[model samples]
Target chain A: MKGLAELGEFGLIDHIRARFPQPVAPELGIGDDAALLSPSAGRQVVVSTDLLAEGVHFDPGFGPARLLGRKSLAVNLSDLASMGAIPRWFFLSLAIPAGFSLETIEGFLDGLAEQAAEHNCILAGGDTCGSKGGLTISVTIMGEQRPELILKRSGAQPGDDVWVSGSLGDSALGLKLLMEGVRLGGAHDPLLLRQLDPTPRCELGLKLAEAGLVNAMIDISDGLLADLGHICEQSVCGAEILLGQLPLSPALYTCSSKQPVFPWPLVISGGEDYELCFTAPRCNREAIQKISKTAGIPLTVVGKVTNSRQVQAILPDGTNFQPSASGYTHF
Target chain B: MKGLAELGEFGLIDHIRARFPQPVAPELGIGDDAALLSPSAGRQVVVSTDLLAEGVHFDPGFGPARLLGRKSLAVNLSDLASMGAIPRWFFLSLAIPAGFSLETIEGFLDGLAEQAAEHNCILAGGDTCGSKGGLTISVTIMGEQRPELILKRSGAQPGDDVWVSGSLGDSALGLKLLMEGVRLGGAHDPLLLRQLDPTPRCELGLKLAEAGLVNAMIDISDGLLADLGHICEQSVCGAEILLGQLPLSPALYTCSSKQPVFPWPLVISGGEDYELCFTAPRCNREAIQKISKTAGIPLTVVGKVTNSRQVQAILPDGTNFQPSASGYTHF
Candidate 1:
């Protein structure tokens, strides 16, 4: 395969266009000074951006370019899901080092196209350039939601019940296993897959917003505790989470049993889960349960908002617990 | 002042917020999962993204962080200007190496805030991350334009008169001077200022589109000939540019006389001018002249679109001259 240096800027862009043609064309795409997008009438636009550096966010040793590209878009989609918006368009800025292969770029585009097609998002516009260092991918996603249906972090009431979607800690444990060279005796471990390719809870988030059940919502990117803390800070409230109530996969439970360190910290503060953590009125429990069944994802009540401004954790045996550090720190 | 390491991610974000607060809050802004913006009725959104890397796009030796920050936003605004769109919001994703200072970041933010206020654009959302390599800034700008007034590259007719706003080659000469270690006896060289802080021809572009005088438009980021070539390709037409008619700043002419090489290629294909190159019907020339007079910017007619598909340059004596290279290649 030819290297990336051979493709140049316009060639790479044309390659991307050929590889990932949208089912419906935008008003303008890939060419011109800017892409033109007609947003849905009467809906508010939601935008989120994320920058992923090579060594800081991922390692070449960890996975192939395809999965890395998938995770990058998934992370941004998670932010849109948190806002209870429908994913629509995205802008990608890629800085790739020399000697990178064109095949690798195609693999990355393949992964991005997969996720975009699944979520009905269009690749609107972006920039690609040569990097003097390692690969850096910056993505900005634009989504839409009705103003009333839009979810923010400031609406959680004191009596709201805090709930989490799917399971947590699996991705964190997967990263730990990858770092320690403990591969669970084979490839394709479920935990490792969780770490490599997270599924954004986009559909479930839209359902909750459409049903008018969620008071406030955020994605569990920087772990359950830290992201929940963000909602609390914005809402001027506190939360008490039950340790035993956190939904953990059977794989996570089994792996933690074999390790010396209690995996509670990973479950609580470890990040990259991409799960939806939200709060709603306690009276909406039955409605949420119905959603859980229809959405095919487990929804667990892990905590409740309080009038105070302290976030506390409760152990399974009713003892108070506190984590030494909170969430992932990029710096 | 505390260093960036001491401030951490959220702390740095809060610092940015305090330093660059929005003129008017959108539906949502910083400190949220994603920003929310409401688009005006019947207007199409124009989106563009650009990535500028240290050493690739700019060096610390070239200018201070303030000018670098201002140029970064200016480049994106130029794209919006090319589309005849009113700039509205921007998202910045910054990757800074460890040990980076807070003072530099604050200076950068100050410059960005100044430009944002001038253009009426809001710093709506962004991502800040730690990089193991050189600093990279990726900016995504969003704008709006009435659908009918939107200027595109595909609208030029065979008889359209090709025009460019302001003088060319000033920015290209500035970079040459910087590299040759000729500081023009220190401080405030007009060429250096042009390269460091290019003013996007936003108001002129808007006037042309609003008056329906321009059929096609593009910013001269990749130089005049190359950018006009883009319009030819999109419009499926040819162009013939006259060398004598090309606008040259006195600074460029003086510098070129001092050097052995002719400045034609630099003026034709050297990048980063950030001026506007456009095409309009011959009948609209008088109207365009009127707008140029009111806008206080020189508008020069240098070329014409043709029925053939070749982009040719002609000398002052009227002989065709072909360039060895067309423009900047990012590879």
Candidate 2:
């Protein structure tokens, strides 16, 4: 395949434009100075932006280009999901190093296309240029939802049940395994996939928001405790999560049994799960469960919101559990 | 001042969030999973994104941190200006390398805030992280315009008059001088300012679009002929610009007189002018001049749209002129 220099900037843009055909009005997509988007009447626009820098966010040699692209969009989609907005449009800014292969770009686009198609989001507008550093991908995603139905981190009240969707700790463990160069063929592949490819839990988030079941919500990108701390701090309340109640995937359980330590810290504070961690009033438990079942994702109530202004964790045997670090910080 | 590592990532974000207070509803700004924006009724949202990479886009040693920040937003705002959109909100994503000083970041934000206030734009959301490479800034600016009043590059007609706001080649000459380490203290400061801190022709663009005086509009980030070339290609027509009629700033003329070769190539193909190049019908000339007087920016008619499908330049003696290159390409 031809390299990026051979393709040139405009040729690269045309190639990318061809991959993601404009799904909206021809005037509203790529090629314009700016994208013109008409939001559905009365719906508010929701926007979230994230950056993935090489050597900091990802290791180029470890993950496939396709999965890296998928994860890039997935992380931003997770932010929208937490806001309970329907994924609509995204702008991508890529800084690629010189001599990068067009085949790798195509592979990246292939994976990005898959996610965009599944979420029904369009590639609205973006900027691409050569980078003197490693690949840097920045995405700004926009979605729409009725203002009254949107979720925020500041809505939780005392006595609300703290809940989490899917499972936790799998992704962090997966990263650990990958770093150690441990490749367990079949059984542990799920763990590795959890790190490489995360599901954003959009459907479940939409359902919860639509049902008016969630009091506050945030995606578990910075781990359960750290993200929950955000909701607690903003909501002006505290949370106490039970260690025994923390949901662990079957794959995590099977892998942890063979390890020397139980890996509870990874389960507690490890990052990049992309699962929804939210709070709801006690009366909506049955309703939330029904919605989760409908969405085919597990919902576990692991804690309760308290009047105190701190996050506390209880061990299974009734002792207090303290993590060395709360979560990941870029700096 | 503390370095980035001393301040920590969250601390740095808090510092940034404090600088640009949300001018809209409190729920619409930073500190959420995503920013929530309510667009004006019946208006379409216009979005543009641009990336300024270190080394490739800017020389950190040459320009001040404040101007670097200002230029980052100005370039994106130029895209919005070309579309006749009123600036509203912007998202910034910065990848800062380790050991960077907090003072530099604060200085950068100071200049960015100045531009944001001038344009009446708010910082709605963004992401910040540690970078292993040079500092990278990606900005996505969103604006709004009435659907019918928005301008585009595809509207120039065969009989239209080609116009440009402000002068050309000043920024290009400034860059050339800076590269050669030529510093003219007082007389040439305007040229340097033109390159380091470009003023987006937003007001002129809005007036032109609102008055329906322009058929096609684009910001001249990619030089005169190159950007006019965009208008020609997109409008499916050709253009012939008068070389003698090309707008040259007084600073450019003063500097060019001292140089051996006339800088016509830079005038034609230099990038980052941030002027407005547009096409209008012959009938709108009087009205456009009136708007230009009211806006207090020079509006010059330098050419005409033709049925041919190429961009051409004519010398003072009516000879065809050729440019060494069309414009800047990142790759």
Candidate 3:
């Protein structure tokens, strides 16, 4: 945030780049007049963008540039994954506070470099400006998916199996603990870790796309119920989920300390998980299992698609429950 | 600035988009799941980004978002023009102030859409966030060029004819007058307008690029002297410029109150002209004229490349003119 003159622009870039290894892509990653990328053949590129503001997105003390860079890219990557696409390139534009230092700027860039490399994405271009305000990170991601194999929110249909990948609620809990002043290395350490470094199911997404096992897809970034409702809305259909069948995690269960917990909020309202939530036709069940085995990740079936335009949940006692709210509202 | 909640997220987008028609390129502009664009052929994309902070880049009241959008894209497009590239897509990340209304956002978007549509470029994707402090904008532009024809800042040589398109200092003058409350009409009006919407010389840029008329190129967003210093540093050479050769408009002359006045500040230290300043072989004078005629833009010879790495200026009276320290300083 200090005037760019204080740190010198070139030096600032080098500092930010120190935290990240060169991306896995064959060409350049950070420093360049331009970036070179190899796109998959016969694929329509999928592009998405998201911006994170200082106060609205994270606590400045806890959400360092490293995490911010990762989360920024992670959220966009999740969007591409929802379409069953392979991420390739990214553009980052950041605004730092006037009092910010070169070292802090570097931290942010380092974070971006690290996460971009992890996903095999090239950091092609970006801009720097001295803002009179808080820190903001804007990321645009490019992904490519085979023309016909791409998944859409509206592809869900009656009898399609609704499945989710990986653990959830940990991020939400982590955020909660942070908000509640819970110390690290406490009983909820794992949950805290999940919140800090939430991984996206990019590999699973690509596999599901390649094997044609997904009908409708979305990322569990906005929580289960909210994200699930997106597919329902787009497909103009209802859904039925058995509460007991929900993929509740161990940390979530342990948070209750042996007491039976409703877990509705954890599974339904916990967001920022970056996991994949998708629906597949019955014919692709074996393919889904094969992916689960090959990727060494569990693919849990949570429910099924329906013909009606309502979302109904059956509790452990066999009583139907409806979502209290759909998803997070940024505004 | 008004709180973001006054307009809501979707309402903000609509307000911004209301100013113009959809962006020129199809597939993506605004209001969609994602923006889409096609990259130009055979070229590794040339991309660059710059972040503008409220207090650093502009005062909110002095420049509108439309101008900001144009300036943001123009700056990146300026980078692409420097590389002899044609821009195609852009991604914008904006952090709106907590006290702003959706109408304020629309003012910015209106400018962005107008400029983008004029250039046949599309708003591929970007992020919008609520800031705790002031406004910030980060723009990333993507462009394409033939692999072999791309120009660089380091290609200037002795004996090259230094050239620039359009008159310099108009935009800067417009800014000064507007900020200082000095006003004029006719050609002067355009000069002030130029400050808010300086043309990027993109068409001339493409022509000069394809015709190979220039050795090196850069856009005059930063003052001519400062920007010229960059080319000199990169190319490891010097330059000799003649003040009389500078293209100053009639309005600039009238600024001295109907008397002949040396407006070198407008010519040399002035920035945001968005014109192409380049070096070409002296032998290409005819080609330059041909391009000038074809592109319907003036291409004038202003000076020559020099042997040493110092920038020397010859004033109208044959006196040496040293450049002042003031120019566009981002930090």
Per-residue lDDT of model 3, residues A1-331, tens digit only: 5545666555566655555455554444565444544455455667777877777777767655567666777788788777778887877777766567666666666666677878887666565555566777777788777667777777898999999888777888888888888756678878876776677778888888888778888888778777777789878888888778877678877884565756577667768888888898988888798899999878889889999887777888999876665555555
If both were scored by TM-score, which would come out higher, candidate 1 or candidate 3? 1
Candidate 1 segments whose C-alpha is farther than 4 A from its true place: A23-26, A182-188, B23-26, B183-188
DockQ of each model vs. true complex? 0.86, 0.87, 0.49
The fnat of each candidate, in order, is: 0.88, 0.87, 0.58
TM-score of 3: 0.87
Model 1 agreement with the true structure over A231-275: per-residue lDDT tens digits = 999999999999989999988888888888668989989899999
Docking class of 2: high
What C-alpha lDDT, on a 0 to 100 scale, does residue B161 get in candidate 1? 94
Candidate 1 local lDDT, residue A326: 88
Tell me the tens digit of each residue's lDDT in model 1 across B219-303: 9988888899899999999999998899899878877887786778889988799999999999998989999999999999998
Error of 3 at A135 (Å): 1.1
For each candidate in turn, the TM-score is 0.98, 0.98, 0.87
Candidates in order have lDDT scores of: 0.89, 0.90, 0.73
Note each model's CA RMSD in angstroms.
1.5, 1.4, 3.9
Considering the two chains of model 1, state its CAPRI-style docking category.
Answer: high
Deviation in angstroms for B194 in model 1? 1.1
